[model samples]
Target: MSTAVATATPTARPTSRRRRRIGSTEIVYLALVGILVVAGVLVAMGGGNLFSTANTAYMLTQTSLLGFVAIGQTFVILCRSLDLSVGYVVALCSIVGATTMAGDPSRVWLGVVAALAAAAGIGLVNGLVVTKLRVNAFIATLGVGLIVKGYLDTQFKGPAGDVPSSFQMFGYTRVGPVPISTIVMLVVAAVGIVLLTRTRQGYHMFAVGGNVDVARLSGIRADRTVIIAHVLCSTCAGIAGLLIAARFGTGNALVYSYGLDLDSIAAVVLGGTLLLGGRGSVAGTVGGVLILAVLDTVFNVLDVDPFFKDVLRGVVIIAAVALYARRQIDPASSRARFRSNRRRDPVRSGARPDPTTTDGGASA
Candidate 1:
């Protein structure tokens, strides 16, 4: 009777362990979502008028620029690459746009075209450096950023030109109470989501980011994917620059240079994308941008020191990275231990051990 009972429960151990793993994953996901909701509520309760139509519009408009850049950073970061050139790209594009369209509002589209081209060109250089020259993405993009900034300084000699009224209109205009910039952001975000979730290339991007060597062996053209990611990142940076210039009505080359990259990275990481790459969502990135915008508004309304805002941002980034690291580390460790134990167990090695087997099988 004892032997029969043991046989009947042979697979229970493995089954229970698998169940534990699924449960753990679910808990982590729920916890993250809950944190976001709670944070949002706290901000609202702390004098942030998140529900006011005007404030909502302002928030959306403000987030649009950073949100676009954050979306691009999401892809690049997921591919385990960093683009420090983002700020420089924004500076250069805004300079070019402002200078070219200074006198003629009708020619603003020309400036836009030129800015996009320049951005793509910068991206191409970055890709070539990383993929062909074997330079690390961090160093390559940082060097490119410095070079671009130098050129911008030489050309602009300090924010000399004003953005055309037409461009400013695009940045400041409202469409039935919705800011045009916000509308544009939503469209871009929607496009990004579609490209990431629906296209075959999107899957390839994810695979390459997840494991480059494996992706290369699987014939996924990882190099092309990296190049494409850089291009997209630069393009987003260009758009951000244009928006900022239009919003302020002047191309302030140095003012935005420092904060642009940091804000984009913060927003992307805060939105739930892994710093190490291969796991993130556009929706998360958007949420992250909104979170930052809300924080900025709340701090301003509450008359908090500007310095404290920076400190809070730093804390959030650290917390996010730590959480992601723990998740990655714990799961891998558990799986490794499970594999090692299985290897040492002769009975579990040969047959499909029953899930109920109680031969020291560890629970996840």
Candidate 2:
């Protein structure tokens, strides 16, 4: 018998390149930041006084309030759900805070606490309806918003009067030349980022949004994750309402009459989170808010009519979504090319087939 030994096959080096050429999140962030910078430059060139301290402060303050709402919207959107009740929640909380505090500086803290509690309660109810009752998030939140709006209207019977002086400080006060509202917004964004990136709960949220059935089978409590997301979102909205009321020194019950949901959704989408869910970042959200604020300020400085602003916003949002969609599709082609290359590699021949491996061969 001739002793024949099979020649040892050299193992192919695993490609160090990441499977994903460009992460959607990274691309979205870069694109948003680029847009913001360009818009800022255009506004400056258009005599918008982009470098003025007052103008910068104004932009920060304006973005701060909307930013808070967008942050809340981020959570809901991440969970693959919608929260239509944010505007109503803001209106209700603002009314409650204004009427109860009503120029009583000392009672500002009480009003703040009450508003937050009310907001959280509303969020809990929304979560219960969606998770327990199996109601769709859109319809359920819409109905809840209407009910809250009606309830607030009944209580106010009209627009709210002046807010407390202490409460006003939240929106108007500054720290080392920075608006308090802006600081608060930054803090909220920071907290949200930490929660989503560092916690196990955050992983569960992604899993839940990515695939509810698979997450459930994998021992994650999808329902709880969604419910938590809703609660957190509403709480953020409530804080935003307080800030808005403080800024104007009054709560008109119609403060949220413009339907903030649409703007919030637009900001979230612009930030790179898919409407279908499971992917995004708080940093991207901040960029999106800045972009919107810049655009709004530019339009105002240009003396564009408010109605025209809506048209502009619609166009920008559509464009952003289209770009994002294109980016999402780009990866598929790269993946296919990678698969083809692997299939043509001779090293794969005569190996025990392993479908789970990217190269379709057993690991050496």
Candidate 3:
């Protein structure tokens, strides 16, 4: 009887898997590629040679410094923090590195070490100020940046000592048609990718940024994660500073002090890394960097006014952010939420449901 009953039972149906959705990061990357195509068209329209080897190399080389800084900024933002002091950190490190080099090739390593140490120290202080003192990251980092910039201004009026030959070589040397600095930027991005996607530390970082209270409940050290992120961000800025000094073969107190911090933030945020933290990817940030570089190149080729370019960029950023925000909602869930709200409404309880009613009970 048991065997007969088992045979008579109907077979269970297999559950269908939902198709995976394209995330904001991938969408942003696609948009970046589209922008590049548009930029190429603009260059052609402007009678500029966009496909020339010279232009390609120039774009890559120019992007390397900003790319490195943006990668670091991505890390910090992923941890739900901001590091406004990176611009000043870059300035201070470049000046210190060049001064230590003193036109002496043999001292290049020493200068590099000194610069990195200084950056790390500044990062540590920023971390402590945020994590220990409970200061808002924006205010803390900005204050620290002001202090660093003030000291830098007091120490040097203009460009300081010359960079060493060895240091300069790193920026100039190329593999075939590519600059070594570009290669370095690519490697840094790769490392960032691996760190965020494959490592335990990376998991903890996302957890912390996603929700600090939940992360702490889960035994993650949110404070330590933030401190580490700041240190890494500062280190990245220091590396960018070294590259900047190498490319210029000199360092100045104020040459690179402007716009770098803002650029990093813009690129990272545009890459679709959540400004609030938790979700992000290094690859998306790379696309973001490229988008910025392409836009700058196109604008220069077209001879657009610098002020107008800035305004255009601001508009683009706002548009990209708004598009991403709209994508965050699921139509199905939104409808379900509306239905749930209607069911709980006292007026709705006595009346028939109105499909056209909006959230505030107004007719759509």
- Ranked candidates (lDDT, high to low): 3, 2, 1
Off by over 4 Å in 1: 1-50, 331-346, 349-364
333-361 per-residue lDDT for model 3 (tens digits): 68966876875684865776443333343
- Shift in Å, residue 40, candidate 3: 1.5
Best lDDT among the predictions, by candidate number: 3
Q: What are the per-residue Cα lDDT tens digits for candidate 2 across 103-154?
A: 8888888888888898899999998999999999999999999998888778
The Cα local distance difference test for each model comes to 0.78, 0.82, 0.86
lDDT of 1 by residue, 18-64 (tens): 33343322434465467547655866788565446776676677688
Per-residue lDDT value at 263 in model 1: 89
Clashing pairs in 3: none
What is candidate 2's CA lDDT for residue 65?
79
lDDT of 1 at 129: 92
- Per-candidate TM-scores read 0.80, 0.85, 0.86
For candidate 2, the TM-score is 0.85
Model 3's C-alpha root-mean-square deviation from the true structure amounts to 8.4
**Model 2 bad stretches (over 4 Å):** 1-25, 335-339, 342-364
The TM-score ranking, best first, is 3, 2, 1
